[model samples]
Target: MAIPPHAQHDTHATTRRGGWPTRRISVTALLCALSFIMTFVEIPIFPPAPWLEYDPSGIVAFVAALAFGPGTGAIVVVLPWVLKTLFSFNVWGHLMAIVANLALILPAALVARRVRGTRGLVVGMVVGGLVSLVASILCNLVVTPLYTAVGIADVIAMIVPILLPFNLIKIILNCVVTGLVQRPLSQALSA
Candidate 1:
């Protein structure tokens, strides 16, 4: 049988190239650059731990994952850290940032994938926040000692008084900012 005239062209041809969508690749790259730039704009929410600054870069990654997919979100999260590593000697800090971001974005993206609408995103953020909180604490216990004079006990001592609230605030801020922008940004991108 002969193919119909309308069916002769591959519908995906314009959207994809070399096993991936060209538009998606471009969009991911743009988001990565934005994320990297946002890293510079950090705010110290917790005075007790001024180093635990909050940056909106994670919002960019979370939105990317929510709009595109978890893989894209993961790339968006890590690329900024990789770029920072080139300029800064803080390898452990970069690694912890990557871990915390992936912990936040991955669960949300996965949950959003399984459940549709805002409800899914919200549920995922909550779960992601909890996961990130624990991950940050554990990471501090391991990585903080490597870079700072703080031992495991010192890190543990800081967790409740410093780390816990800091992570919670950061997670909430990222989630709220992402929630505000995600739908509008997704619509704009699709348009």
Candidate 2:
């Protein structure tokens, strides 16, 4: 018996403009909105750097990358930064955030794509977290001095004591949350 067109898989399925599958675009947009909303719910995990609060927006973006691929994940990461920057006008902070998040999401997504399975994801998270930690520190050295009263020296001083720990904690939190939810969310979204 032949499968109906609606029920059959189309290997040559038509994509929307920009080559994104329509479903991927829809999922990415929904995840972007969630990530944007999550930006408001920040938790101060590090006392010395309360200003460097943690938000789960990255988790959503990371999951989007894991599910849909890096491009969708990147859009999910940037949309929140754009929206937050519009409201706060903190261009430097938002730019740093984009760098940090993309650092995490891109590597994780790429590694996960290459490796496959839970092992792949675990390795991806570790690699992504370390990359994010390094990127945040480097961005802080350059960008923090531009916006805040802190000089480059001051930012460097804060790196080992404050920034390092804060970013480590933030990356771990995002990775853990993403790992926990990724499979379930992927299953649900695919369904």
Candidate 3:
């Protein structure tokens, strides 16, 4: 099948010496910058865990993945935290965010790449959202205790009451926001 218009390659774009095209690199950088800036603009959702904040950087990464493919999207996912780690030295949370965002974007980007159209997008997002939820639960099980004073049992207890719902809400919001902007972003990039 022909590639969707949104997936169409930029004909004039140069990938000199077989490297990534300038446009792709620029877009990835822009997305990473946006993600980095977004980290500071978080909102606390659960009162019990006032420290856990929701940042929509994942949505920007997801849009990059959807527009450029999952592998490139994965780079976009990691770049912000990699940059942040340089200054903050907070490895655990950044690592968790990397895993969570990758899990969130990959399923949707891979599926959408194969299955075109609106239905495909919705299916991909739903599958990706579920993947994010489960991966986050597993990641929290392992990573939370290492970083926080809380134990595994406490983390487990918080899963159903806090983590599960919070992750769901986060992914859903990312999905909605990405769905709104990805098409236009893709089209503009392709142009």
Candidate 4:
């Protein structure tokens, strides 16, 4: 089926921003699959918080963003999440992961496209990452309490510390890895 004119126009506009072809799609898919695999390579930081395990999956999506852009990066983000919920239906964790990822990945993608150097990139992303982290936390803290009048205070206390650093790490790692990889990949992409 033919894409509608408006859709075609939008795609062409995005292409004008930065273009990619079939090989780029293949490269992005490879990275997305690698990200899903990396989810299994988790380190449990603690015990009772079974819902919380550290993973480096975000880095791969960041690579996709750097290689392509935000639209392509979003494609990979959903894939791993769907695969995870299929394997084990932890609805709460999966939902949280999805929300948290949307909260985190986008700004990082925008930043990834513009980042220049390792150290400078690190500082800039950390600042931007903090903005995302705080916004999400405040939204959660305010809204979560409204619904559950119980020890919402305790929930915030428990979650905020863990969440803040996790987000910070996610952005920093994504930015650093994207910065390191993008230049070399550009050579392949330009060809």
Local error of candidate 2 at 92, Å? 0.9
Candidates ranked, most accurate by lDDT first: 1, 2, 3, 4
Pairs of residues at least 3 apart in sequence or in different chains that clash in candidate 3: none
Residue 101, model 2: Cα distance from true site in angstroms: 0.8
- Candidate 4 Cα misplacement greater than 4 A, ranges: 1-20, 45-51, 111-124, 135-151, 159-161, 186-191
Error of 3 at 4 (Å): 20
Which candidate achieves the best lDDT against the true structure? 1
Per-residue lDDT of candidate 1, residues 124-151 (tens digit): 9999999999999899999999989988
Q: Model 2, 58-106: lDDT tens per residue? A: 9999988998889889999999889998888878878888899999989
TM-score of 3: 0.88
lDDT by candidate, in order shown: 0.87, 0.86, 0.85, 0.62
- Using Cα atoms with residue i matched to residue i, what is each candidate's TM-score against the true structure? 0.90, 0.90, 0.88, 0.66
lDDT of 4 by residue, 1-191 (tens): 56555444334432443445445667677877887887677765545455457677766665565556677767667678778878877654555555555555566556655775564346545654676577656655655555456366776786746656655565566566666776687567545
Off by over 4 Å in 3: 1-18
Residue 135, model 1: Cα distance from true site in angstroms: 0.6
